[model samples]
Target: MTTATLGRLDAIDPAARRAPRYGGFSWTFLSVELKRLFRNSSVVIFTLIFPVAMLIMVGLPNKNVPISDVPVAQGGMSAAVPIMISMAVYGAMVASTMTGVTVAAERTQGWSRQLRLTPLNPVVYILVKVLCGLVLGGIAVLITLILGSALGITAPVGNLVLAGLLAWLSSLMMTSLGLAVGYAFPAQNAMRYLGPILPILSFMGGLFFPLALMPDGVQIAAKFTPVWGIANLSQSAIIGTAPDVWAIPNLVVWFLLFTGFAVLMFRRDTKRV
Candidate 1:
C-alpha cells in the first residue's frame, strides 16, 4: 500500500494528473499589464501634459466669458469650467484609448496568440485592458483637475467630483475604440488612423466648442458622435446643471456599441490565429 501505490500513481499520465485549466479572470495579470503600460514614456508624458497645457493655454483667455445663450437645462457655469472639463475629458480619453496602440503592437509581436494558451478568458482579458486604460485615464483626469484648480477654475466640491468621475467613465468609450483599431489593424497603421481621427472625433463631439455655440446642424450631428454624450454629461456635472434629454442614453448607446464592436473584432482576430 506504500511503495506499490506510489509507483502506480507515478505511472499515470503526467498530463492526466495535471489540474484542469478553467479559463477566468486574473487580477495578477491585470496588475502586471498596468505596470507595463505605465512605463511607456509616450503615454505617461501625453497624459500628464496635454490636459494641463490645454487648460492653461486655451482656457485662460476665455475664463470669465459667460456662455451667453445656454439652455435652462444646461447649468450656469462660466466658460472656464467647461473648458477644464473638456480638456480633461480629451486628455483622459486619448490616454485610455492609446492602450489600443499597445494592443496592436502586442498583436504584431504575437502576444495575442500567446494569450490564447493561458487560462484567461477573452472577455476577462478585454475587461482587464479596459480597467487598465481607465486607471491610466484617471491619472490624466486628476492632473487636469489639479491644473484647473491652480488656474482658478472653481465649482462646488460635489460638482467638481462629479465631473471628474464622468470624464473618467466616458473615457471607456474611447478605450473600446482603441481596442477595435488594435485588433482590426496593424500597430503602425492603427496609429496612422487613430492620430488624425481622435481630434476629429473630439471636435465632432463638441469638445472644442460648445454645442450651443455651434450651428444647429452641427449641434444635431454632435449628438450622434461617440464623445459628445459623455462630454456633455461631464460639462453639465461641472456646472451643476441637468444634461440634455439625450445625453445619458446617447452615452450608453455609444459605449455599448463600441464595447461590443471591440469584443467581436477581438474574437475574429483570435480565431484566425
Candidate 2:
C-alpha cells in the first residue's frame, strides 16, 4: 500500500473502521432505494408532484376563501397563514404515508423476497426505506412553507426556519407511522382503504381548521392526536408563541410507540415469508 493509504488506515481507530462495515447494509439500501425512486416516473407523482400540487391546489393565492381555527381570526382558509400552512403539511403527510404503504404492496411481486435475499439486513432495509420517506417529506414540507410565505403569507425568516425544522422532525415521526400502518396492511387494498381516511382525521387534528370552532370536549380530544401535537408544535414556531412544553413529552412517547410497533410488525411479516 502507498504510505498515504497506510496513514489513512492508521488514522481510523478500530471502532471507527468497523462502524462503516457494520452500517454498510443500511447505506447501500438507502442509495439503491433512492436510485429506484429517481428512476420511477410514477413514484415522482406520488412523492414529489402530488405534494407540490397539493400545496398549490389549496395554498396558492389562498384568495378563494378564508377560515381560522383561532377565534381571533375567524374567517375562511385564505385568512390565516398558520392554518393555511398546516393544510399543506396535512396534505403532504397523507401523501407521504400513502406512498410508503404502496411500496409495501410490492412485497407480493417477488421483489420483496429478492431484496431480502440480498446481504441487506431486514432491519437496515426498513430503516433505509423509512429514511427515504423522511427525505422526500422534508422537501415537501419546505416547498409548502415557502409557498405559504410567498403568497402574501408572511413571517420572520427565523420563524419560517423554525417551522420548517419542526415540520422535518414531524416527518420522521410520520415515517414511522407510515411504516407501521403500511406493513400492518400486508397488502395494497389496506392502503386504498387508508388513503382517504387519515386526511379526514386532519380536519379534526386542526391542520387547516381551528379546534376552537369544534366542541370544547372534541377540541380537547384533538389535542391528544399525534398529528395535532405535531401541528401545534409547528404553529408555535410560526406565530412566535412558545409551544406548550408538554407537547414534547407527548410527541416523544408517540414516536417511540410507533417505532416499536413498526419493528414488531415488520418482524412478524418477515417470519411469515
Candidate 3:
C-alpha cells in the first residue's frame, strides 16, 4: 500500500514471488484426469467394453482356427490371436483419441483459459492429457487381453505380454492425432469426422483382416495408412517374426506430423483465447 511496503516487496527475490513451476510431468494432475475420464459412461463403454464385445463376437468362431499346423511355440498362432491383438490396438486407439478429443470441450468451457492462470505449465498440461490418454489405452489393452485369454487365445506369456505392450504403446500416435483434431475443430465436429475414419484406417492398416488376403492393390496401399506399421509391429510379437523394416519409420513420421500439427493448433487456439 505504501512506498516503503512496495520497496520491501520488490527487494525480495522475484523468483520467490512467482507461482511454483510445474516443470515436469505432474502425477497428481494425471490422477485427477484419469478419474475424470473413468467417470464418463460413454468413455467406459466404447473404450473398455466395446473391444471385448467385438472379440467375443468375431473371435469366438475363429479361436481354434490355426494359421499354421505347427505349435504356437514355433511361431504358429491361432487366427484369433492376431484378431484379438488387433482389437486391443483398436480399443487403445479409440481410448487415446477420445482422451485427446476432450480438449475441445475444455476449450469451449473456458477450462483451458483457466489453466493458464495456474502454476501448471502448458507443456505439462498437454503431457498430462496425453498420459491420461495412454492410461486409458492401457486399460483397453488389459481388458482385451483378459477376454482374449478367457476365450482360449493362448501364446507364451512373454509374447502375449509383449504384444499387449506394443498394442498399448502404438496408440500414442492416435493421442497426438486426437489433440491435433481437437485443437483444429469444434468438439462435435472432431468426433464426427474422426469416428468414421478410425475404422477405415483400421481396415486399411490390416487390423480387420490380413493384408495377404486382400487384393494386391489394396495391399500396396495398406502399407501407407497410419495404423499399418504399428498394427503389424504389434502382431509380430505374437507371430514371432521381425517387423517389416518400414514399420518404425511409418510410426515415427506420422507421430511427428501429428505432434507438430497439434502444437501449431494449440498455439492458435491459445491466441484466440
Model 3 misplaced regions, further than 4 Å: 1-24, 70-76, 118-121
Candidate 1 global CA lDDT score: 0.84
Between the candidate structures 1 and 2, which one is better when assessed by lDDT? 1
| Tens digit per residue, CA lDDT, model 2, 169-260 | 76666667777777777675766666676776677677767776889898788767777777887777776779777677767887788777
Candidate 3 lDDT over residue span 1-273, tens digit each: 999999988899957756655564557778888888888788778887889988998877887777888765566678888888899999999999998888888789897677655565555666677788888899999999998898788777888999899899866789888988998999779999899999999999999989989999998898888999899898898767788899889888988887778777887788677
Please report the TM-score between candidate 1 and the true structure.
0.87
For each of the candidates, the C-alpha root-mean-square deviation to the true structure, in angstroms, is: 4.9, 7.7, 3.2
lDDT of candidate 3? 0.84
**Candidate 2 residue 143 C-alpha distance from true site, Å:** 1.8
- Alpha carbon lDDT of residue 256, candidate 2? 82
TM per candidate: 0.87, 0.77, 0.88
